[model samples]
Target chain A: MLLCGLTLLHALVSGSVPIPFATVLQLLGGQAADPAAGQLQTIILQLRLPRALAAMVTGGLLAMAGAYMQVLLRNPLADPYVLGVSGGAAIGALLALMLGLGSSLVSGGALFGALASMLLVFGLSHRHNNWYSEQLLLTGIVVATGWGALISFILAISPDQQLRGMLFWLMGDMSHSDTPTLEAMLLLVCVIISLPLATRLNLYAQGPMRAASLGVAVQPLQWTIFVIASIMTATAVQLAGAIGFIGLVIPHIMRRVVGADHRILIPASALGGAILLLLADTLARTVFTPMQLPTGVLTAMLGVPLFLYLLNKGRRT
Target chain B: MTVLSCQQLQLNVPGKTLVSGLDWDIEAGQFWLVIGRNGSGKTTLLQTLAGLRPAAGGEISLHSQPLQQYRRRQIAQRMAILFQHQESGFPITVQESALAGRHPHRGLWDWSDQDQHETVFSALQTMDLASVMQLPVDQLSGGERRRLELATLLIQDPELYLLDEPTNHLDLHHQISTLEHFSGLAAAPQHCVVMASHELNLGLRYCSHVLLLYGNGAWEAGRIDEVIDPERLERLYQHPMTVQPGSHGNIYLPA
Candidate 1:
């Protein structure tokens, strides 16, 4: 992890305006950047630093949320996308853009949409006495279809010039990040607020009946964890325009590597998710050199191969 | 004093009624062995009492509080259940799974050390299961999981213990050991243990009282001598079952 961080620092320092290690060190140590350090400090400290941090945090949050989703739904194949969280978030961000909200409403809007989807799914899935997994699956399909219709409606009525920006946003980008929301995302500290501590979440994974018998407040506890997961997933979607599989791919990879103790897996996954996304973003940004590709497309490109390999390995295990 | 009282309790499913319009009261510290054949209402009665399923009509009261008034967690703290059947394989360590019984006793913020650890530890040690503490639950041989679950139940430490076919999968040695262990639970004045089983001879030997569930929802709850009848069994279950004397002066079946 330290090596990865150091490598990233080195990469950031070597951007269009190159900064010396000594100047990077001085700036990190709380001293002002030397005039001799010039535009390099400006690029590294202001632009590259926030971008890198944002990628890492977003990736980490998505992965943890995805891991929680698979466990909560009790389906090995379940991911955030299957529950309509991703689709709702995408539709919300799309709508916000069409309204000329200009990115400020993106994260919270996505989070609100995710929560609405969750409530809808929960209400629909509840049966006479207990919840059935089949009902939940159907609800997800309904909500995702509804969100798709809304997105299409907004696009069909949008102006031609605005249409290009809307399409680009939907394709996903990290460039929408500003100084404030990124700072707010940092304050969210998903690990502290999420899963509502490791022990309860760990007990919950054993299935609802056992958990309830053991005295877990199953209904309230589940809702709390779900809300935290929704917030984290929404924040990630807003920052990176609904990037795919950071949640799904990273947790699966970590589960194969680390054991399933959520106490250990949660922290390990957060770090793993952050590091993997940072490297993926770095590769996306640098691979085409001067030409840029959307970080979301690159993530999917990287995720699919890794995901398939993990799937094959999972079958063997 | 009656610790559990039922007033006009009726358990009914969609098509037919299992047990209906029955009124009974069981005093504190009185153990019951409710015996019935397959398709009889023994399992249904127990599930209804445990609040897992709703009673079609009638009311049950525990310690003067209506059963419906107790939330799931409150009920969990007061009663524990051991299933007659369990899933064979689960991917977790015995210790990790056993600790789950402490689920109701803990607050969200912190896990109390003295209570949680002491409760789980004593439960494990009491069942002679400390040796297999770290073993994977799935890796344990067949009868071992039942013992582990027993430890979990003990950790729950509810005043009322409910068992459904508790001895179903055990070998002869384990069956006797389990029955004997249950017979020697906490001697508090209000503690009660209730189970349903086909092991009539064992039920006769250990249980303080018996509840016989028969055809057409015909029922009797009283002393074993009053309820166990050869002719009644022959007519109801349609099997020529017999009971004989055993070495401990308790009843046992030779055939």
Candidate 2:
């Protein structure tokens, strides 16, 4: 939480204009009486504040979804995108860009695409009220591959002029995000719904038969996790256009720090994810002064080394 | 009182019918040993009885109600199963793993309180795992893991225990002590146990009843003394058996 606060402050203060810490503090405290407060308020409140909140909520959503996905699939390498959500969202966003749709429409397209992919996976894998984890995972992988092929085909014929915007959306760009009230609400709801299931999820992480023997309704719990994770991944892709590493790595890092009890791990992963993305987004916007790099690129560059170092350190200890 | 009863219970795996038209009633304070050769439906029968799998045909009742009528939580409150294989997919402490047994007893928002912690600690101590309660489960040895699983089942504190090979990975001492513990548990007024095992001597020593699965949809169930003999054992195993009287009981050996 302290890290989240610090990152939020840094994101509000560091930009092209370089607003002073005191001024940022004052603007946040509703004291805008200073003579030069007008422009600073616009920069902090209008521009950076929304982007920072977007990053925070998007990060929390993705990380929580990723944690649940790992348990649901019983695989450490599972991520939010492992189920083809990002692939579907990427196709939607790229198609919107090709059609010269407005930014709002692009987000809408991505959300639609994500939901469609979720339904497809759920439908294909579910049979006779029983879906094995392996069967679901295999179905998702094959569908993701199909979506990957479609994505490549779409990129093949698009005109050169709109290619950059399409690429930005595919790689993840948060510059177009407005105030994140909806996504923030979504993150809160997901956290609330998931916290109650944390204890049950611990038993679930053991195996299905064990969990069932221990009093968990394995089938219903599995279905709930699938739906909840799908919604969260869809929301995150809508907000940030498929930002990658936070969802995959943040849960693992938090697991090492807080242990595997989902009660603590879920909240810790959310905070860790929020901080990492806030820091990365701040760097992505400020490092080059005028030109901005894709947030996904920066997240990968930052997260890969951190994950590898932690994994090695864990092994040594 | 009848703790668990199955009428015309049937169990199958793919194209093979392992057990069929079976009727059995497990009364309170009765310890039943389900003995079968390899490829028989011992595991499948136990799983079906525990509501972990659907029976091919039959009705199972717990406390005079259909097994399917109760919620999973309700069922868990009355019964617990110790599976044959234990796998931990993620890192968890021994204490935490055992504490999961308390899941069905607590409400959704309730955390593990002091009483539950004490219970878990005692259970771990019983399993001789108190000193390493904080260690990760993946770091435990096979025998230690099996004991940990037993400790978890003790913490669950169910009335009906359906244990599949409760002595799979235990050492000789642990095997004897664990069976003794279950035997003691089955002597309680409202408690009963149904275990699957191949240890004829131990089963004869501890269990009051026997369930013999012949691996071809044929089975026999009765008091251990009446249901078990060299002739029945030979037919059950498809091999000649010699029975030797030991100090504790009769031991069956293949000839």
Candidate 3:
């Protein structure tokens, strides 16, 4: 947690404008006295800080959502995208763009799309008191495939003028996300709701039958976790574009550090995810300065190899 | 006092009846061994009594109230079940897994406190799992995993225990030790233990009450001494069987 705060500070000070640490601190502390430093402070305060905060919130939400998804589905591979949630969100945003909708409306479209896919998967997987994980996974996989086809169709038909921006958004860019208050609030609410259910979530991961035997309200708990994860994924997709890998890998990594108790794992995953995405977003901004990359691209590029290495190492152990 | 009771309970699938028209009562300080051939619905009956599955047709009450009427946590506070199989989605240490048994007693926002830790610690020690407390369940041997399961049940400290194939993966020594532990629990006042098993000898030795599930929606329940008829045992399994009056208890063997 301390490391995440320090990294956030470094991110604020080391952006393109390179505002001095002292000026950044003064601005943060509401004590900037020099008029000459006002523009640099505005750039840091207005542009960089909010961007960093948004990335952290989005990343934290994604990781927590992924963790709970793994528990509810009882599948280690399950994530926010495993159920076509991100795909649905992307399709909604893309459809909005295809209609020349404004950016704000596009976010709403993404949230709507996410909820629709979530409901579809939930409704399809239901079968006479049996919410089998395999059935849910199969439903999610098919729905994701459907969303994938629609997203591709939309991309293929979109005008050339909007292609670059659309592609960047799909790849997940934090540059265009200006505000963080709503996402931050949502993130806070999610964390609070999730923390109380962590123990039940852990038991549920063993299986619905076992969870019920242990006295967990298995159906209600599964549904609650599912909705929360879907909402978090939708919020993340809205705040950033469609950042991946972090959601899937952050929980795995936190499990190694904090063990499998969800009480500790949830908070650890939240902080670890925030730090990871903030770092990835920073690299995305500064690595090729004149031409920034989408944050999701960098996360995947970095995450896949790291995840494989960890998995391989775990096997060896 | 009667802890659990069922009336006209019918457990069936789409076109098959496993057990039906059953009326049974379980009082405190009694151990019931559900014995039957494979596909005889022993597990189903146990699960139904645990409230994991609704009976096909019947009513069950826990302490004079409808079983379904009790909240899940309320049921958990009074009953704990050990499943036949368990899986983990993440790497969880044996100790951590056992600690999950405390969930029924905990408030949503409450973390395990000192007393809960002591309870888990003693359970681990009792099951001889203290040596591997930090090891993940996946890494443990089959016998170790079974013992871990027992350890988890021990910590739950429920008034009623429903175990499905509790002796599954245990060795001869562990089989006896685990059964002895359960016998001790069942001997205590206001406590009960129920298990589904194919091990007729073990059931004969330890169980005070016996329920025979005969696959075609037919069944019988009684005190073990009154129900251990060699002819009925032969009919239950569709084979001849020998009943030896051993020093400890009767032993059933195929004749």
Deviation from native of the Cα of residue A214 in model 2, angstroms? 0.7
Arrange candidates by DockQ, highest first: which order?
A: 2, 3, 1
**Candidate 2: residue B7 lDDT (0-100):** 95
Model 3 clash pairs are none
Per-residue CA lDDT of model 2 for B1-255, tens digit only, reads 999999998888999999999999999999999999997999898888889999999999999899999999999999989888876579888888889888889999888557798899998888889999989888999999999999998999999999889888889999998999999999999999999998888989999999999999999999998988899999999999988889888999999
lDDT of every predicted structure (CA atoms): 0.72, 0.90, 0.86
iRMSD of all candidate structures: 2.8, 0.8, 1.3
Candidate 3 lDDT by residue in tens digits, B1-255: 999999999999778999889999999999999988998998888888989887999899999899989999899889988877776556677887888788888888677456687898899998888989888888899989988988988888899999899889998998998999899999999899999988889878998999999999999899998998899999899999987888787778999
Error of 2 at B198 (Å): 0.8
Model 1, chain A: how large is the TM-score?
0.84
Tens digit per residue, CA lDDT, model 3, A1-317: 78999989988988666777877888898776778677777888788898999989999999998988888777878888878888888998888888889998888888898889888887899888567888999999999999889888889988998888788888998997786898898888888887888888888877677788788888788778877888888889888878888888999988877777787888888888898899889889888885799999888877778778877887787
Q: Among all windows of ten consecutive residues in candidate 3 chain A, which has the lowest summed lDDT?
A: A30-39
- Residues A156-270, model 2: lDDT tens digits: 9999999888888888899998999988998888888888999888889999889999999998999899889888898999999978878789999999888888989988888
lDDT of 1: 0.72
For model 1, what is the error of residue A284's alpha carbon versus the real structure, in angstroms, after optimal superposition? 2.0
Error of 3 at A50 (Å): 1.4
**Can you give the DockQ of every candidate in the order shown?**
0.37, 0.87, 0.74
Best by DockQ: 2
Q: How close to the true structure is residue A141 of candidate 2, measured as C-alpha lDDT? A: 84
